[model samples]
Target: MNIKELQQYVSRFCDEKGFEGIPLETRVMYLISEIGELTDDLLEIKGATTEKQEVIKRNIGHEMFDVTWNIFDLANKLDIDLEAAFKEKMNINENREWKT
Candidate 1:
């Protein structure tokens, strides 16, 4: 599905399963925490920390998805319609590029 479809689908899934509780900021924090964990995994192999590389990589995928989902959630919450907005912005960019 496209971005808007996916946003609608996720919203439906969230509503159907009674999965509402945390605030947007909390989701953002979780996303940041995941990014930190992923970074730790990458850095640990270079003697930067003690976390395991393989384990951290696995968690990183989940965290990255968390980050993506929240971005979609925010988009949907604000009725921003990212799929169309992106297209609109790209058209402007295409018209403006190298126009000096």
Candidate 2:
């Protein structure tokens, strides 16, 4: 689903999960923790045996989803349009000079 729809879904979930009253800063900390988890999985993947690699890969994917879920929830709580912001940032990046 698109970000807007996913944000709405997360909003409904927050209500059900009682996360609607959670502080913005706390939500941000949760997001940071998810990022750390993702990093840990990446490190594990680097040294994983072939069979273990699949499990680590799935863990990494799940961690990444958690990161995005937190991001969407935070943006919804703050009334930010992430899709719009991402597009605007990409447009700005498209015009920047870069070293070869």
Candidate 3:
């Protein structure tokens, strides 16, 4: 689904799960924690044997999704439209030059 849809879903989930009471600072902390988890999953997969990597790969997607969900939740809590923000950022990037 698109960013907007995903944000809406997370908002609804938070409301249903009583996570609406969570403060923005806590949300930011959670997002950071999820990022760490995702990084750990990536590192595990990278260093694992082929067979073990396959097992770790399965958990990697969930970690990635957790990161995305936390980001969307943070955006929602801050009342930011991630889809619009993303598009605006991309437009600015397209015209910008990068030093390689």
Candidate 4:
């Protein structure tokens, strides 16, 4: 499904499960955790870092999805339209982007 559908799906999931919504701070924390996990996996796979960097790389895709889940969760909780949001913000990004 597309981003809009996925956002609705994740939001519905929380509602259907009788789950309380996560706070924005918690969602951000999860995002950071997922990024750290991805970084550790990359470092390990490249053999460019310490053994301490050897986090379980196999499940990073799941972690990434989980991060999106929380993001959509928080956005839906706050009644944000992510599609329009991104489209609106793209103007700023486009102007600031360097030519590849």
TM-score, every prediction? 0.59, 0.91, 0.92, 0.69
What is the Cα-based lDDT of residue 61 in candidate 3?
A: 84
Worst 10 residues of 2 by lDDT: 1-10
- Top candidate on TM-score is 3
For candidate 3, lDDT tens digit of each residue in 16-97? 9999889989988998998898788887787789999888888888888998998888888889999999999999999999
Q: CA lDDT of each candidate?
A: 0.70, 0.93, 0.90, 0.75
- List model 1 lDDT by residue over 1-100, tens digit each: 7877888876876678764555778767766776676676566556533456556667667767776777776666566888898899998998685735
TM-score of model 4 vs. true structure:
0.69
Q: If both were scored by lDDT, which would come out higher, candidate 2 or candidate 4?
A: 2
Worst 10 residues of 4 by lDDT: 48-57
Segments of candidate 1 deviating more than 4 angstroms:
19-27, 45-56, 95-100
Note each model's CA RMSD in angstroms.
4.7, 1.3, 1.1, 4.4
> What is the overall TM-score of model 1 with all chains considered together?
0.59
Clash count per candidate: 0, 0, 0, 0
Give lDDT: candidate 4, residue 42. Answer: 61
- Give the least accurate 10-residue stretch of model 1, judged by summed lDDT: 45-54
State the lDDT of candidate 2 residue by residue for 10-50, as single tens digits.
99999999999999999999999999999999988987799
